[model samples]
Target: MSTGSGAPSAPAPNSHHDTVSDDATATASARGTTPGIAAGPAAPPRKGTFSSLRIRNYRLFATGQMVSNTGTWMQRIAQDWLVLSLTGSSAAVGITTALQFLPMLLFGLYGGVIADRFPKRKLLLLTQSAMGLTGLTLAGLTLSGQVEVWHVYLVALLLGLATVVDNPARQAFVSEMVGQDDLRNAVSLNSANFQSARLIGPAVAGVLITAFGSGWAFLFNGLSFIAPLTGLLMMRTAELHKVDRVPRSKGQLREGLRYVSQRPDLIWPIVLVGFIGTFGFNFPIWLTAFVYHVFHQGAGTYALFNGLMAAGSLIGALLAARRAGSRLRLLVGAAMLFGALEITAALAPSFWLFAALLAPIGMVGLTINVTANSSVQMATDPLMRGRVMSLFMMVFMGGTPLGAPVVGWVTDAFGARIGFLAGGVISLTAAGLIGLVLARVGGLRLKIDLRRGHQHLTFVPRAPGAAAPSGEKALAPAA
Candidate 1:
């Protein structure tokens, strides 16, 4: 079942949410209609990293995402392999990737607007179904020997369009399932779930493509949509926490942008991730180049590199799931480590050492992703979450299309090592610059205390005349 009130309004900027368990629970209690929110009524939620699974709705959602994510990963690998086989040019694979992410760059904001206007549950159902069909169609074409580069390109673009809507709605819907109490845990688990699929999906695709053909892999991907569809159908709608849907209106796109611009915390992290996503995360191109040209190895070595990275990523996500908080410091710290590791790996002398570095790099990269995602979602208003998250997804993912061609050119011209090193330099520089900017805006100054057992470093209050971060209050110095 779907839930939405007509002409819903957003919460005020300074509105108090502490009184409510979260936006959904607050809405439910206010209406006194929805059930399954109170602890007494439901079974005690599971503890630690898997706590979010305690909610029946979330449990079903996670199960579906797990299966669907694996299929999605399979399709990603198979699609690229199919395109490369047909065209025999690495450029063709890049084009396929660009086409898939291009929609997010172009129209992702409007997709968020639509998500805010409709029921997230229903939107997900539609998008998930559409994705499934696209997979099936591609499978049919491949199995029939009718597949072409153009056909793959077109399907990639269609899938990207579906993702533009799916990403934001799917992100915002987590809060609806578990409320704020479990939102952080759920977000971390979602990352873990994807990474776990990353481990399974690519390996499975490699086998399927080699054994039966890429067509069979596509067929499995096409069929994988069943899990998510079934999960959505099985969900008990009444138990879902409510979120106010924004009614259709003009300037919503601008409204979302403006809202983000005014919030320093939101905008800075988004900016930091955007830089990391665009320049630092071009792994497919970089890793492949390293495997063939630098390491003088074949597909097997590349697969090993990817598998180690996925293992690290899985570790990072699970660790994040255990923690209840998301901090900007964690986000900044993880990004720095990620950038530094990339630079180190790029310059490594031995293949074994380089391969070993991949795991830590993947771990830190996942930390950056999961931290940014959870922090952004936790900070945004429930009413504006869809739009805010849309922007987050846009900058984090959509930048790839724009960045990939440039990164590809650099790799082609200067060699893979230089390209990888340059990406790390940019990422590290951006994190440092953004960290300073955040401190300046927040009216915070660094204070170093060298006393034993005391904090070695921290942010201290700025001088009395210093401006506050927002129009709100600032930290005053202790008398």
Candidate 2:
């Protein structure tokens, strides 16, 4: 929707190491010191929600990504329509989606390692170029009337391979561009950029598909890569804030795994994401099925639903940008709300009513995504950012391969409504369980208070040695 490797030798917990300068910078930033900047009088308050745009590199990156992300979404819509046109089967669509994400499930961890070991800008140049070429090849094949489902499958796999590297590099690179102080805002704005592109891309793809054919949409997407490539080339390398490159080590992957294992703040969110992503995030499959089978609609109607959802997502992202930090409570509440709305939408009797529900559904979904992403990035060590983010993405996006096919099959066999219901149930259950786990493990107790004739439930930290609940330690703040 758009929404690891084999076991190695275990490394000692908390034994992860990094360059002294990088470690010092991270520590200073945690203490409110601007890393690499001379101390001076208090800076003026940031002006607006888009404060991260003040940085030259991030501005360039965001502008380029806006264009590229639109193209990416265009291709996504075109590809799905093409598969449906070729096979007329929802299960085929699911298989295609699964193949696209299979590499992430297999080698995403290795991609994180690569991101950590190399210059992020250099790696991004290579990956982005490779993705562009893949897009062009697909456009040519489709235009020449030689395209087949297998061709689509092959191209999707290639793109997925590129993304395995691109995703982690892009995520970790944000720290270098804006430093820690604005990371949450930067991450939120990135989501806003993506969703805004989503608002434009699918609608355009729908028109292109209906007016000409899927080939033109693919061709447009192929050419759209130029914007990101140009932006990357134009970035001033000297102005970039550089993090330390991780040195080669035998047990580094194991070390990343061990590090994540020990942090409840990190692990629980990842686990919750894994559940929701696997079951809840199959929008392409579910939405397409609902449009074609349930509503008896065409390409325009499918695009409309997506556009509406993106509109909500954009609003949610902008709201997140106005905030200074991420919290577990926000993540949990958003997930539950997203799941509940999805369930309600699934039961809608009319297409218009169903479409109306998608807006709020998109809003809560984006809220969960931004909160989870920012919290993880902010709480992680700089040296471990790539590996940690790779793991987070692996759980979030990689679960698609495992879930899409099954969800597609369920939709085909049962109905689109049941498929949606299944996803919502899984998401709701995951949020409830994870929330309770976090509360118990973090020494938080839920207290119900009556005020102004209203009852409220609040989680408050308990007193020391006050019979703390037996569980893992609460997630430590970013080190």
Candidate 3:
């Protein structure tokens, strides 16, 4: 089933070759292959957020990711717990996290070049195997009572190195599995899968750590790699929709940087994401502080908060799946809402009220995530997808190394409430500034009108020969 550019070219068509199914006929007609057949009506497109699940390859990929994501979250919780148990220092925990993401900031661009030159599937196999080994090594060290802070640090750095490559390859690999037709649905479903795992993994990790120890959680994560590795092996190669591989060449990394720099749509969202990611997405630091300092609670309460957020995130992902397209306005609005909600949660007087607000915070946060991811992917050229997505991931995830320490310092110096307030203020400010920039760059004119006792805001393109608005001009639309 696998067809590549290396495959022998098909023979020229002859009069005798006429076998074709009705579906094939319809496809050919749609493509203008047969002028007579093109006269007929076209078939309807499939609908639903789960439409991507109908693809065998995507089904396998999602199924595997669900299991792997669970283990990933479990290890995340256990790692933090173990570090805290050993040192009782939040700053130590921040350093550990910063180490895990430091490689992405330093080497993520080079990883994109590798992804563009190589086959993603093959590259993933190697990276995933390396990560699994790191997990097993950590598990062994923990179980033997020989795990030192240095050992954890070393393993975290190693895992981050593997992730530098794996993240980009995996992000760009979705196109090959389901093609553009189902890409948005696939991305939303992937988010849902991760969020669902979030709901289960931390809760399970909490139980394991309470009963057996943190060692068991790490051990389980080590074994969880089996599912994804198996799924990769079983995919039908021929069915994959292969994209053109960029030839090995000099300056490719710089070329990617130049490409993104010129495109306002790509760069602006990326900038917003960088700010929000650096400031707003420090959930580990924030959540841990809330549980230990504000609520005076244990690991169980911490797990419950995460579980509630994950539940909200899952719902948001599903709602995103039902939508057909991504919009820049939606991303900006969601970012603003997410920030506002976080501020509200920070000021909540009661524990249950704070927990209640977390659901909406999770919802808006996922909405922004899904919208930005899909919009960027849909806008980029196929040849540049790997590099562009790598840049996006680098900005989104790499910022953690820079921001976590600052947030942790703020928490330690001030209180956890001040930390939340700082994050919210940064998030809201980013959204507002980015919104105005996008409006100006896109030549969009905003109007306010009163209807049914409510004020409505709308954006419209300027008309030709009309008096120009102060800040409006013709500009390219974001794809």
Candidate 4:
């Protein structure tokens, strides 16, 4: 989302790093769509990705979130390692992951309702505090040496319950902070901050896990929550432009479902996200299992791989920030490229070759992510933003809980090679299928409107009287 104070802002704590990674879906919704979407000259001035930071409130929020996100990543590495250590099964790690995200999948629609009904700032305070406490509790149990697998499972489930409400609130809150004008930039910059933290946090976690234990990482993450909470409290609510929360009516959920079903602009991006998410976005499961079991490496290697990917992701996000307008053609093209890159990475024979592939993988993934997000957000009406965004998130993040465990099983049963191959196949298939669906819906016969502004999203069929067949192409005004 917008990681600034009032004019911008925005977790579920699934892992200690849960605070960072899980929130990306919400952040994508916040930025990819809402604000700063416009037609402009190519190559604008070098406004830093963090240009939203020029706003005092947003700067404070971004700084706090950046610090907290680093700690969150540290916790995620530690948590995954701890689970692996305790159960010694990739399946267990996957289950823990599923539990953490299950709430989002099951209750995402309900969560949107909660966000629409509540003031987001106050809601965030509660969720952030609950998440922090969960991390602290896990740390205490682990440090006291009373930790067990069940404890991790329980806490993960609890953190997930909080996420069911928290995720949507945070996504909706970003619109309030930056207004719509700077929302897109703020959102892209926010993703950059997250990936930057990913680049740093995991490498640091690798060192900490190798040197000490998981306990300190959890403790550090628990304490990191204070920074964001303080930032939230310090914000001047009087200056914030809170959105008008409409009272829920009968069949509100169904109405939301119907709203998205009718519009290809909104529905296609979310469906694409689901496909990629289910097949492509199992990095944590794949990477963890590969480094530990396949490559015969340890935590250090795992952290390095993620950090490198984050480096690529940072570059991708920055490039995306420079994109003046959102387009589905660009999104589909990037997704296809991303899937191909992942396939290449999967087939790489050497560890160095595989690691090198992660950079472009990150780049392509971020490109598709930012583009799809901005396209969906900018296209939907403001009244339905929260619900629409939540569904968008459900497709994006919800696929993880459903697919990760299956991917984990495949990796355990077949091999890490097969897992990566399967992921690549799924991603490519999703992109292609979604592209076909969009083309049919938009009545296209191969012509793409990539450079056209967002308003040109509507593509109606040329009428019988509009044109003749042979030599010249028929054109009509966008509805």
Candidate 5:
């Protein structure tokens, strides 16, 4: 649901009173109403990733995003391909990629602060409209056959600036749509939706580029933004959940850094994601180069590689959706597996074999991504979620600006093979280090403790960061 500039009021206790089930348990629970539930006699039936669909507003949001995201992917491929066509320098392509993400590195923290201070739906509306205009500008330049590499760069910067606001608004807005109860499921399904679009977007872009021109792809992307804008406008404002907006302290950005530093569990995952984003996940650079240079193929092959990876990613996202709760085990295990698969794919003998390898690579990578995202989002406080997520996204995406050029240079200097191998090694090494760090900090000594279910967990936080516990006294008890 959408809300205006002001914070939405708390939902009324009698909001769902009319829809009671005709059962004794239901009657008991409905005796006195509450905002989330009637005073329940039993816990609600467990729902999975699709739980968000029960809310009509979120369903509309998802549907519109799926359509728009596909076209966005098309523009991304077209932009990269156009740069490569003009310059033939992987370095130039890397620079363009860097420009697109550079804002996340520089402005991401402040973007988070803005998300906290503003109304997300309104913020999204403005950003989305701006992006649409940027896309239109690209289309006009390209379709008229007057586009230049410099124009592309300038347009990319504009779009990137818009994304700085769009990213945080969208991330924080999800929580407001679906309350905390089904948030993990909503997050998983959202991942699945994105991967599903990934599976379609690039392939379609490839065909469109071959048939008409890159300009048409740009035009399609420009038009696509309308879906999201419409969705935002049409949402029911009253149902939105409001978060208390806190004024920023002078060193709030520094405070965010300190908060991350204090949590080994959170810090390590962010570190691991940063490593992967930097080295392991430069698919734009790798796939395009792999097709043109190594395989001596054209745009079709490039699109095929991305599509196969997305196909794998789709399954991975679904599997994550099937799982009920997030687990640190999933994060570490998936990272190791993703790295191993990436290494194997780099060694594949033929183009088809390498393309086939993308599925597993995509699967493991997506699993790690969704699991890490859900864990971090669930762990953070509502008040600080925007800043924390922004930090997470900055580390995850910003590393690309620093690493893309290096990876591009490596691919050019040594070979694509060496570049892939190096990334895989770094990723695996990161996973191992994170596991060890968790063990050391969480006091995990490989001993069993059945009472608290510490088997899967390596480190447990001593207290709630959001709330202070009551006073306690230490005591000795018989074993």
Candidate 6:
């Protein structure tokens, strides 16, 4: 479904900060994703894995997001299934998906510009309310037996419009909540929360879809916005880590683009994800085909598949939350594994075998998401974060508009296996190429050891005196 913004412009809340610890700076220098802010004294480590939650504002935000993200997942399942049922064509499902993300493709950067200038909390309130209204409208039409394919299309477009702002704002807002010190942890935990909801949302959506109809799921999703709206209202603005707003300007968008282009640490990861997102991450298309066509399963099994994937994603996100830094090598490695797993899953001989592979796919997928997200946010200047993240997300989700329909057609004509396999090959190739380029930029080369009980693989400096800026400047030092 889609949502729109009828709310008139209001002044936005301020932005956030960028800082790194000495240790994190050294590690970043070695990895090529440093924030480029000079190293400060080493900061004490966070007391626990959930250190970000120690901040009251972040805790409130997290609790609220957990509810809404689940709702969002529910809508995704119901919307896709509903479209497939109505049209009886996976390509139609693809079209629905494309429409939903097309706005991100077309207008995502503008959303980022708005996000930088506005108060995120207020922006979220507006966006969330609009999204909830769209859900309610869709629910009402479906429940009243007046809904049509056209109605779904309209709602999806509207929703995408709202998301163009909501997504960039919400992502940049995280750093504002906990500051750079706990930014990575917060980002990881946010993924865990989304996946946690993924597990529950699909199951619930499955049950609701089967028993009543998709309408109830939509209705529940509409109401789910209440939690976040309440949370946004309750947050103490004074407690937020506020930064100066970017004054309105004509060339701001170009500035964000230029910023990313100059930084290899930021650009390569974004480029890697763009390729991966455009091809490999067509799960909605792939999974729907597997369930409806290949496995001949009902809604319950589809939900089960999603839940299993969610389980793995949750594990990966939690693991990421515990670490103090994000490495380009780690991100590259995860992307490779994700692609390999997808190829394997596509060729699985049995339904159960196919299902079993999904969990790991989900795991590595979350790893890529968390790693790339934190790394980019860390390396960006605070003033440009909204625009940078918009670019990151646009390259990621926006690519769906280009990929989903093509993947859907491939599924329809060549069979789901061909479509899935093609995506995997592209993903793996992209990851490998990006990894090599990043390694070269870092002035490092892969080292291999043939002996038993020795380290089998590592990256070493190409020359003793070589400076790997990508490693040294990729991320902020741990703070």
Candidate closer to the true structure by lDDT (higher is better), 1 or 3: 3
With candidate 1 superimposed using the best TM-score fit, by how many Å does residue 385's alpha carbon deviate from the native? 0.6
- Kindly indicate the candidate among 4 and 6 with the higher lDDT: 6
In model 3, the clashing pairs are: 1-238, 2-238
Backbone clash count, each prediction separately? 0, 0, 2, 17, 0, 28
Candidate achieving higher TM-score, 1 or 2: 2
Model 4 lDDT per residue over 1-479, tens place: 42221211110111101112335434434544211111111332344556666666667677878888888888888888899889878878888888888888888888877777778888989998998998899999999999999998898888888877777787777667766656677777777888888888898888888898888888888898899899998887776766788685887788778877756566778888888977798887788888888789988898898898899999988776655556677888788888888888888899899999998898888877777776666555556767777787777877778998998899889888888889998888888887766655444434346575644343333342222122111001000
Q: Arrange candidates by TM-score, descending.
A: 6, 2, 3, 1, 4, 5
Tens digits of lDDT, candidate 1, 1-479: 01111111233554412232456445545655331111112222344778778789989998998999898888887786676567644556667777888999999898889888899999999999999999999999999998888999999999999999999999889888987677777888898999999888888887787777888878888899999989999999999998889998889999989988766667888999999999999887777678767887654555677778889999998988876456677788788888999999989999999989999999999999988887677667888888889999999889989887788778877888888898999999999888767666555667799999999977554653333344322111100
Model 6, span 63-133: residue lDDT tens: 98889889988898999888888887888888888899999999999999999999888999999999999
TM-score for every candidate vs. truth?
0.86, 0.89, 0.88, 0.84, 0.84, 0.90
Clashing residue pairs in candidate 5 are none
Model 2 regions lying over 4 Å from their true place:
1-47, 453-455, 462-479
Candidate 3 — worst ten consecutive residues by lDDT sum? 1-10
lDDT of 2 at 125: 92
RMSD of 4: 9.8
lDDT of 3 by residue, 1-479 (tens): 00011111221212111233568556655665432122222322436768888889889988988888898888888888788778766666777888899899999998888888899999989988888888888899999999988888898899999999998899889889988777777888888998999999999999998888888888888888888888899999999997999999998898889877766667888898898888998888888888888998877787888888999999998887777666678888889988898888888899999999888888888888888888777667778878888899899889989998899889878988889889999999999889888776655556688787765976544442222232221112231
**Residues 1-479, candidate 5, lDDT per residue (tens digit)?**
11111112222211312233446334543554321122322422456546678987788789888988898888988888888888876767777888788899899888888887788899999999999999899999999999999999888878878888788788878888887776776777788888898889899999998888899889999999999899999999888887777585687777667766655446777888988888888888877778878898877777788889999988988787667555565687888888888788878888778988999999999888887787667656677777778888888888888988888888778777777788888888888777665544432333436765457433332332211111100000000
What C-alpha lDDT, on a 0 to 100 scale, does residue 39 get in candidate 3? 23
lDDT of 4 at 265: 62
Q: Note each model's CA RMSD in angstroms.
A: 8.1, 7.2, 8.9, 9.8, 9.3, 6.4
Compared to the true structure, candidate 2 yields what TM-score?
0.89
Model 2: how far residue 336 lies from native, Å:
0.9
What is candidate 2's lDDT per residue for 343-446, written digit by digit as tens?
Answer: 99999998889999999999999988888887777667778889989999999999999999999999999999999999999999899888888777655667
